[model samples]
Target: MWQQSQAGWQTDTGAGSVMQHRLRGLSGKLLWLTMAFVMLAEVLIFVPSVASMRLRWLEDRLNTAAAAGVVIDGLQPAELPRAVQDDTLMATGTKAIALRKDGTSRLLAADHMPPQVDAKYDLSDVPAFQSIGDALYTLLFGGDRMLRVYGPIGDSDMIIELVMEEKGLRQAMLAYAQSVFSVSLMISLITASLIYIAINRMMIRPMRRLTHSMQVFAENPEDPARILPPAPGNDEIALAGRHLALMQEQLQKTLKQQRNLADLGLAVSKINHDMRNILASAQLMSDRLVDVDDPMVKGFAPKLVRTIDRAVGYTSEVLAYGQASEAEPKRRRFRLAELCQEVRDILAIAPDSGIDFVDSVAADIEVDADSEQLFRVVHNICRNAVQALANHRLDDPGALRRITLSAQRIGSVVAIAIDDTGPGLAPKARENLFTAFRGSARSGGIGLGLAIARELVLAHGGTIALVEKPGPGTLFRIEIPDRPVALGDWRVRA
Candidate 1:
């Protein structure tokens, strides 16, 4: 997971570096995109601008030709001189100018007018799209074409027509286009620069800092110093920083726990070897004590033997616990009531400890489980309750100090609950109730009892939990289900 994160960060980092990577990086890409959109907006304005310019140019020529034709029309039958006519046509920038009144066409001026114009336009009511298209066509390919333009003479009945070469108009349009492009290019650069700077400061820089922090944190997650300090703000960047900090804290704690477990496993490995030898020797000595005929010794010898046997088994389990593995339960059908009695015996709470052990399991109730593992699970919880009650009774002598063990067969599962009436679990212990080392509230206690108990219960494909119950003390429920019966066995039983 961290490798993928680092790779992604590196890719983004590379994108910020050189020209090749710049286009791929967030900052550079946004810069280019800003420029592109601004330029595109300018293009939209440019189209209408050039079209409007073209319309104005044609309107001016029409007005000039109409004024000249009106003056010449009043001089009926008196023709103007050829040189004057040619000068009038030149002034209007046209090859010919004519006036039409009541279907009668009259030539007002002529200067080598074309036999037929290449294109004709009735500009009095041209559509917007057609006018734009015509303007663009003139700019692109109008240099060599001849145009005949006709329009009404300002609400008058007469219409004025002019034949003109498009080359001059094309030249004007090209110059105007050049000016527009220069200004548009400048505006686009300015706009794009502003947008790029704003986005870079607001988003890109923060993201880069986040990625860099992640890379550093991933390198040594166990180091609490490497955790990110959450950035201040309500924005996503700040939120992400806060979450990352939280995640780092949790990961650091988990890593620390794992490291402690590893060291513990190693320590146990060395200690158990010698510890086993000592316990084995004690076991042999206790076995010989059974032969003593003293009444008290006879009664206590069996209990001592059972205690040593349990201790030996516990040592092996502790060694296994350190290695983060355990033997699978050696499951068998057994009476659960008998197992509860055994846990009570193993704890052997003093009668005057001000603690009472209540066994509420029915004698007939049976469970399918590893007897020894189930014993550990119950004994560990019952023992903790005994300790808690023993301590609580000293502070509050009148307080009810009791641990209750209850079991029942519910369908194919057996539910066992251990409730105590001393004091409930501390807030911190409850939070890490089944977590080794951190779960212990008592000083000098490494909380492996509940952790190991939970592990053993889960090994039987069961669930164990600290349940909320009214009144004082802690209540733990363990549910172990019966293994699935084989089809062949069921058929035989049927």
Candidate 2:
């Protein structure tokens, strides 16, 4: 049983060995991916932005020089102020050129001038007089390397060309890029760490709690209730946690109920052995009732005898249902509708109760089941529904007292649904509906009807569930597998 319970977990975890052994959960991978994407985007945007800003600053400085009466021809090496000359000489040292108003140009600062610049200068004829204006020409040559800014001095015949080296601007941009890259990397690392921690706390932790609780429950089913904590909000994960917790609570309650039922079954097995003898004696006495001439005795004797017989049969069935362990299903292909009718007839519901039994199974449909055991399963459910209706009628006399049994074949499964128009099971009862004594409420009868029904269905490799009913009615559904089985294969081997 433990192996069977652990199989699903093993299958899920086995597929991702790395995930299982290294990273605790998928959140770690997600955090890393998020951080990587953020860092990449920051690098892409920040590098270009810093470069553009530096180029704009250099252009502003050149315009300032031009505005201060720096002309191409008159602005000779000696005529320039020491501060301006020194700054310009140092600034343009990497890639500077001095252009004269006579269309003459000299390389004052560059170690090497690119071929495109000399060719373009000759082609455009180096404008004799250029106006210094607010509008600056911004151009990029060969993949954002070279930025050229050209303008004229106010009312001057000389065009002042200050060739600023891109290498320095490139270096400044590189330094800024490095700083941005470092900061972005740090931010990404921090963000990823925070995301990993937050996700683990908010999502993974609760899931682990749920998984651990389930493992514990599976190991020792008799252990006390251990429920997962409620999620903090109404998000989908929180809702899933809530639902999982509810399901665990229900399962825990069910296991407890089954434990109680096992105990009850043990006790009932002993009592049943003794009760059968007493019932046998009573059957002999009942046989003698036919000889009694009193009309009152005649009318009531059969019912009393039948009731006692049914009680004896019910006791025997309880023992069989509880004690059997993995016995082969005593399956036989039989008409389901006929079996339902048989169960209704055997219950012998009272006329004054005004209870009605309606069967809706198709006539031609058949199912494979252990006739005796399957009969007990159906009889118990139908009897319970009838009893519920009878109980309701005692209170609200006008209430509809009907129990409807419907069966249909859906795919390879045959479903039988029993609905009763009674005050549906109480919330507490519903919570532990199929749990042995746990299903009982204020009005109770050992709470074994549904439990026994479920066990019997499971014995035949089938399922029994409580269907959701809207109001004032209980709906129970039993689904049996439709596969045909040989009688020899189904019978008890011993």
Which candidate has the highest TM-score of all?
A: 1
What's the lDDT for candidate 2?
Answer: 0.67
Off by over 4 Å in 2: 1-27, 57-72, 75-91, 94-96, 100-158, 162-169, 190-221, 229-241, 277-444, 447-494
What TM-score, over all chains together, does every model reach? 0.90, 0.50
1-494 per-residue lDDT for model 2 (tens digits): 89976997787778677565436556767787879888888867764566455546565645554544344334456455446556655544424545455576543333345555421222122332221111112222322344444555555565555554455654554566678778899988988888888887888776676677778767865555557667678877778878877887778777776778778877877988898899889988987996799999998787677667777776666565555643466788899988887677688887776887788889988988887678878888777777776666446566678888898888778888888887777898888888767676338588767777777798778998887867778788889996654688679543
The all-Cα superposition gives candidate 2 an RMSD in Å to the true structure of 12.9
Clashing pairs in 2: 130-152, 131-152, 132-152
Candidate 1: residue 271 Cα off by (Å): 2.0
Worst 10 residues of 1 by lDDT: 390-399
**Model 2 per-residue lDDT at 178:** 72
Tell me the lDDT of candidate 1: 0.89
Could you give me the TM-score of model 2 versus the true structure?
A: 0.50
